[model samples]
Target: MAKYIDLQTFTDARGNLTVVEKILPFDIKRVFYIYGVDETERGHHRHKKTVQAAIALNGSCRIMNHAGEGLPLEEFTLDKPSKCLIIDPEDFHWMDNFTKDCILMVFASEYYDKDDYIFEPYKQI
Candidate 1:
């Protein structure tokens, strides 16, 4: 099952800290960022082996998920630095319509591999 984990962010006069680390729940093997995104939608893809923790470091956006079967499509809003949406490998996920200046960060359980992704609106094999 997909679960939402609210990360811990410490704020002070210096700055705010929202750290992503490897722990029991997630062993962070890779990290990536998605930027230069317009107000339009993008990233309608799903991974076959990678599990990810998606965070909104700046601005806001939404994440939609649909499991392999006729699972109900669920939507989650990313607004705060302390919130994250954890996705399992079997779930189809996408990030859409980000705010103009949004910076999306992802913590993954595996390194980048071209074969790991399946672009969305695609036939399920």
Candidate 2:
């Protein structure tokens, strides 16, 4: 199942600082970011073993996810740097409706492996 996680943020006189330290269930092995996206949507598959935590570092985007096993489709908006979305292995997700300055940072549990990806989206039940 995919869920939202609130990252710890410290606001002082200077500015605000958010941290992604011990809150994740798995240690991150891969990190990536998405930006300069066009009108098209991104991410149409799910990983077999990789779990991901996605954070919007700059702007905002909408994530539509469908977890298997007769679960209903779910939607999430990542509009804040302190908000993280944990994508489990069984969750099929796609991102769209991104703002111009959106910078989505993703932390994965495993390194890039083409064979680990399942490219099929779930059919609506």
Candidate 3:
């Protein structure tokens, strides 16, 4: 599995903003956005070489992830203004139970390629 780098955010009396100057470990090569309603669960897939950082820019969303040989599945709920979840290769991830106007921002090391994606259904835990 790949490593995680959590970006830092600072807040003051002015406002809060995410800083992305020269702290990223990898060069950002691609960006994607997912926004809308999720009546059912979605994104049960794996990326062979894509390392991604997901941020909830608007509303909240739930993320389910499975990584490593015997690593147990984990779930995360993101709703803060600057909180984010980093996902690495070999991890199966999905988004579920999102709000009506939830906005998900993803930063990737590579562009989108169909050959790099692996879709799978939710299995027994």
Candidate 4:
């Protein structure tokens, strides 16, 4: 399952601020941003242990969730800057239907390691 997090935002004459703490149930060890993707679908795997949070910064997009929990796939629309999707470990995830100039900022609780990820997709049996 996924967790929708409401980030704290402050606005004034200068600009707006969305605050995120890297501590609590876990700590942030990696951060990255995605942009300039029109037809590309990113992320097709589940982490072995790392947990992640995805935040949309620019345009809107759809996130696909397919965790191996004997349930159907789910879709989430992320369009707000303060809206975040918290992806649990072993939750197979992907992104699609990105609007132009879409930016998705991701924060993770672990470093990037090829061995720490599962990339096999579901197959009919």
| Candidate 3, residue 65: lDDT | 87
The residue-by-residue lDDT of candidate 3 on 1-125, one tens digit each, is 33334557877999877766575556789988888865887788888888887877889898888875467788888776477677886788889888987898888878889899977633535
TM-score of candidate 4 to 2 decimals: 0.89
Candidate 1's clash total is 0
- Model 1 Cα lDDT, one tens digit per residue, 11-40: 999988876554327688898988768766
Instruction: Kindly list the per-residue Cα lDDT of model 4 for residues 12-35, writing each as its tens digit.
Output: 999999888643257889999999
Q: Clashing residue pairs, candidate 3?
A: none
Best by TM-score: 2
* Cα shift from native, residue 75, model 1 (Å): 0.5
Which digits, one per residue and each the tens of the lDDT, describe model 2 over residues 1-125? 99999999999999999999999999999999999998999998999999999999999999999998577999999999999999999899999999999999999999999999998878877
Give one clash count per candidate, in the order shown. Answer: 0, 0, 0, 0
Candidate 1 TM-score, true structure as reference: 0.83
Q: List candidate 3 stretches off by more than 4 Å.
A: 1-6, 121-125
TM-score of each: 0.83, 0.98, 0.84, 0.89
Deviation of model 1 at 91, angstroms: 1.3
